[model samples]
Target: MTYQDKVILITGASSGIGKELALLLAAEKARIILSARNEAHLLEVQAQCLSLTPHCHVLPMDITDERQVQEGAASAIAIYGRIDVLINNAGVTQRSKLIDTSPAAIRKLMEVNFFGPMMLTTALLPQFKAQQQGQIVVISSMAGLFGYPWRSGYNAAKHALQGYFETLQTEQPIPGLSTTIICPGRIHTDITYSAITGDGSAYGAMDPGQAHGIPVDVCARKIVKAMRNKKKLVLIARMEKVLLWMKRYFPPLFYFIARKGN
Candidate 1:
């Protein structure tokens, strides 16, 4: 399927993978609707997208806030009449060990990474059902597939996200209503610097591995391809792939690797 004229709404479109995806889809002539908490950054991305496709909208929204999410989707629907695709890319990560992490921090991470997207997807369910066809793309992490060090909270949030959406994909009540979860190992982004710490503050540290991960544009392109193919799940990054392989075929080795690393 082509993206031409498709009205696609992407959260976290202010920067990184979301911004790249917006530009890529815009080039394909899709009606791009951008959402994020950063209005300035959103406007910047909108300008770039509008250069490629005339139908570009910037809707500043914090997905963690349920009200903003609902209102944002309503506003998008008001403009476009229908949404063909919804990309849930807005999320937060954690950098502290589970024990050092504050309860409040875990709750906040869950709110941003899990509940926020879940709420938005539920809000748009009726619209999708009415349209008779829609795609839901979730930006889960490799952490969602396997445990990693100093990120139990982040891992937990992603794991829950995977469970919830994968289940919905299985129970797909209507034909053409699809779900695709994209799990990236590391796509060089600001996520590291902005990752929440044990005390609920930005970690302010960018891991070397993340700083040098696969390019964001490449990741965005792959995700778009997966969405077009309506793939159930896609994983990127060699480390993540290996970990999943071990987890599935060699449980003992998976535990051994996890323990040695984390």
Candidate 2:
């Protein structure tokens, strides 16, 4: 559970939960490697990390690019000699009704939300296996737990990660290797604004659910604790926590309730 001296790499570190996590972990004395597509935003995050702690570095790269993901992983290993934690937090969302969803829109979501993380994890798996000790943390959504209206592609991608990572855990049971899949209900972030719209533009709006879900700082702390404790699955949010349990025990009722969720 000790974070001191551990090397942690986080994608989507440019802003929101990822940036908050970087700052928190840096303050805990963990060596941090921040990666995202925006060099400018990455630098800003790196600066903030430096202000909090000196053990922080930036490796800006587009997660959607396999080569960049590989290079970024190499850079992290080169910096700290090894990676103790890899947080797959980079993802994009889209809000569109199923009937209106286009092939292109779904592909875009898959590229960033599903394929990007899959590629990044695949690139890191070798090192983790060789060491027999590493943590892979995935930032999924409650949408992954159940289908949500107006986010067909988004839900599918997250659901895919949950399936793949969970199976990866059973298929490759490396001693000391750990995977934690996080399903967050909502939070006040720019995620909605950045979410792809039906017309292929940013949504540029906020959802009330996200506005009142949880604070980013609180969520970051919970995530760090879960990672350090090596939790296999962690669901965060007041109402979503209940839904998580329901989905496991009362499938029929869970489906009915989920159908009623907005």
Candidate 3:
């Protein structure tokens, strides 16, 4: 479907895949609403989108905050009277193993990566129902499909996202609403820099795997294509695709290779 004049709300639109999506969608002449905790960065992204299209608004929000999420959902609907799409792209990663990671750290990851998206989606459900049509895109991770080293909380959170959204798809609470779950492997972004450690502190380092992975723009393009197709599920990866196959067909070899992965 054409994006021209479509109202799309994207969370975490300040940078990475979200920023690229905003720019790309803006170029398509879609009305864009950007949301994230960093108002300054949101404004920067808004300015960039404004250069491409006339319809761009910034809604600063911390998804983890239930009150803010409720307000943000209402404000987003008010901006364009109705939202055609909601991209749940805001999330955090974990850099600590299960043995060393604190319970609080795991909870923090859950709050942002799982509960936040669920809350926002729930808040916007009525709006989608009122419109009688909407699209929900969730940016999960390869970790959701399988476990990996040094990412216990991240894995759990993404897995939770998979379960929740997949169930939503099956339930079909909104008749004309559709859900797209995207599993991306090691996209070249600075997500690792904000990764939480065992003590819930930022890892503050770029991951070698992420640095060598698919480009952020490429990832965004694939996501948009999947959304337009109304795809049920999409996997954007290289070797991780093989790893998933191995996990399904040969568990032992998958474990051995996954252990050696970075």
**Top candidate when judged by TM-score against the true structure:** 3
Residue-by-residue lDDT tens digits, candidate 2, 1-262: 5787888999999998999999999988889999998889999999888987778888988888888888887888899889999999998888778788788888888889999999999888889988899899999988788776788889999999999999987886678888999988887778888888766678788877778869999999999999988888888778877877888898887888877765
lDDT of 1 by residue, 1-262 (tens): 7899999999989988999999999999999999999899999998899889989998888898989988987998998899999999998887888889999999999999999999999899889999999999999999998888888888999999999999988899768799999999988988888898999999898788788889888899999999999999999786768888999999999888887663
Best-fitting candidate, scored by lDDT: 3
Clashing pairs in 2: none
lDDT of each: 0.90, 0.87, 0.95
Question: What TM-score goes with each of the models?
Answer: 0.97, 0.93, 0.99
Which scores greater on lDDT, model 2 or model 3? Answer: 3
Q: What's the distance in Å from true for residue 261, model 2?
A: 4.3
What digit string (tens of lDDT, one per residue) describes model 3 on residues 97-212?
78999999999999999999999999999999998899999999999999999999989999999999999999999899999999999999999999999999999999988899
RMSD of each: 1.2, 1.8, 0.7
Ranking by TM-score: 3, 1, 2
Q: Which stretches in model 3 have alpha-carbon errors above 4 Å?
A: none
Looking at candidate 2, the ten consecutive residues that score lowest on lDDT are: 253-262
